[model samples]
Target chain A: MEQSSCTVVDAQETFSRAREQTLIESVKGGDTLAYHELYDAHVKRVYALCYRLTGDKALAEDATQEVFIQLWRKISNFTGQSRFSTWLHSVAANVTVSYMRKQRGWFQRMFSIDESEAQYHAAPADAHSIDLEALIVRLPERARMVFVLHAIEGYRHEDIASMLGMAVGSSKAQFHRARQLLKAWMGYDED
Target chain B: MTKTNFDDALKQQLDTLPEEKHPERDLWRGVALALENEADTSTAKPGWRSGWAAMAASVALIAMVSWYSLQQPSGPTEPSAITGEALVQALSQQHEQQKQALLVEYTDTPALADNWQQQLDELDDAAAAIKAALAEDPDNPALLRMLQNVYQQQITLIERVHAPKWQRI
Candidate 1:
């Protein structure tokens, strides 16, 4: 029965992929209805990613719009070498990171994590319950970017380094830095 | 409070993070308006290029028709030129006009990367620098490649936001 159920699940997944692929093709042809359907199917996941990366609700909203706009423009560039979800995640990451970087001034970026943290606008606090998304936003800029990408998004440190244009060591360092900061935020940095 | 280790707790929370989160607002309306605007602006082409644009359109139509027949019955398949239709037909004229339209449309759209305009301007400024260098050594292959790369980047920046395609897929 377990083996039969597994086969049924796999078949369902294959069916879903084929349907998604069809919808994607329709979207490529300027089919707004198809695009709308496609958007409906994926919007929440994309928005979540945007919010996680941008840290601000408004920015996430704008970035979400930009990601779909980009999708409308570059869906053709998606060769399907990767799953559509994976590919969209990559695009969302690029768009969100680029958006954040653009918000920062050239001189304010990444020479050191401490300096960037000073510029970072930490999230607002609550009296009793700490906010998860806000905690992420409160993280230092470089460390925040690294932590979100590495811990949450599952990107390798090397990949994070390349995306942020920092050394691989810097990416790893930022990840550790983020962990400590998050711990402190959670009232756990007892040492 | 139960003693949950920070790393373990955080890891578990992060791992269990849902794949989806509904935005507080509807974004489709904005996206739809943008798409509508692009289609309207493109169809209502600015004058000047309408001259040779006729020739370009004719060429693109013929190529698209050929490519369309070959496309799988599954929706709208990409044209023969996978990079783009213009790339497929080698119709630089049509591509240039489309590229310009996109550049104009996305001109005010803010780029999120730092020094976004500065970087684009730097690429443009490098064009002048290339021109000045060419005054000394006219046939340098490296400079030639740089010039091509710069133009391509400009198109990429523009199309990165507003390149349109036509197909069933």
Candidate 2:
């Protein structure tokens, strides 16, 4: 029974992967249904990537939608040189990075009002659910991206390097730095 | 802690993090419907737009190619524009001459008519094969390049034959 269950699970995963490949090929051939299918499959992962990068829900949501919009515009250029997930991640990474770079000038203005805004959105003090995720929000941009990819998404340094256009060594260094920072923030030294 | 231990710890932490969920399918469906409803009739939908754009782009690309071709000096109203058949004939002529040149190198005397006749017969067979291949794909750039290279080599061989060898001073 266990062996049969394992095979069933493996088959399901394989079927889904093949389905995604078909959807990508169809999208390249200009099929709208394929677009919808691809969008549905990836929107959350895209949103999570954006959210982790930006640490702002609204910005993440907008970036996620814009990423899909750009994907629709550029899907024809995708000649399947890389896995579809890798290509999509690269697009999202680039879009988020560009958006963050452009928004840096607004940081000073936002900093002034950040405290009041934080208080307004703050959940109850004893809330375990919110505080854990809230700790992630405080992480620096590069660290957050490293943590999201290396930690949350199970991507290797080499994969992250190709997706983010960083050197593999730099990706490892960033992952190390992100881990150290997160450990510090969470007060793990006492443990 | 050792590097391996640190990595193991990090992996555990990452795996333990909560998976994020987005708004429900119905909400996304509603958004999709709204976007579709607002679609500009002036600009056709995405798939059709890409197809139309691809066709337009191909035409423009071909036009650019023709424009560049025009920039090169075309001989004025010449009856001898380079065509596929002309090119095959040129290659046949070339292969024959090259075979003769190679044969002459062995024979010491350059003008052995019997050797030259055998080379010409081989060239005729080669030219027939080339003509058939070129007929299948006349516009293939790779074949065109190969044909051009053969023509240039033949010209050089002809020049070599015509040149006078130097006398000792």
lDDT of 2: 0.57
- Per-residue lDDT tens digits of candidate 1, residues B1-169? 2235766767676777778989988787688668756655685422112312332343334434533454435555333423332232243354457657876777776432222354445555655555454445444334434445555655664543233221112
Model 2: docking quality category = incorrect
Clash pairs detected, candidate 1: A25-B169, A26-B169, A101-B114, A102-B112, A102-B113, A102-B114, B76-B168, B76-B169
TM-score of chain B of 1: 0.34
TM-score of chain B of 2: 0.28
User: For this target, which candidate reaches the highest lDDT against the unseen true structure?
Assistant: 1
Global fold similarity of model 1 (TM-score): 0.58
Error of 1 at B128 (Å): 59
List runs of model 1 lying over 4 Å from the truth: A1-8, A104-131, A189-191, B1-4, B43-169
Native-referenced DockQ of model 2: 0.11
The global C-alpha lDDT for each of the candidates, from Candidate 1 onward, is 0.66, 0.57
**Model 2, residue pairs in steric clash:** none
- TM-score of B-chain for each predicted structure, in order: 0.34, 0.28
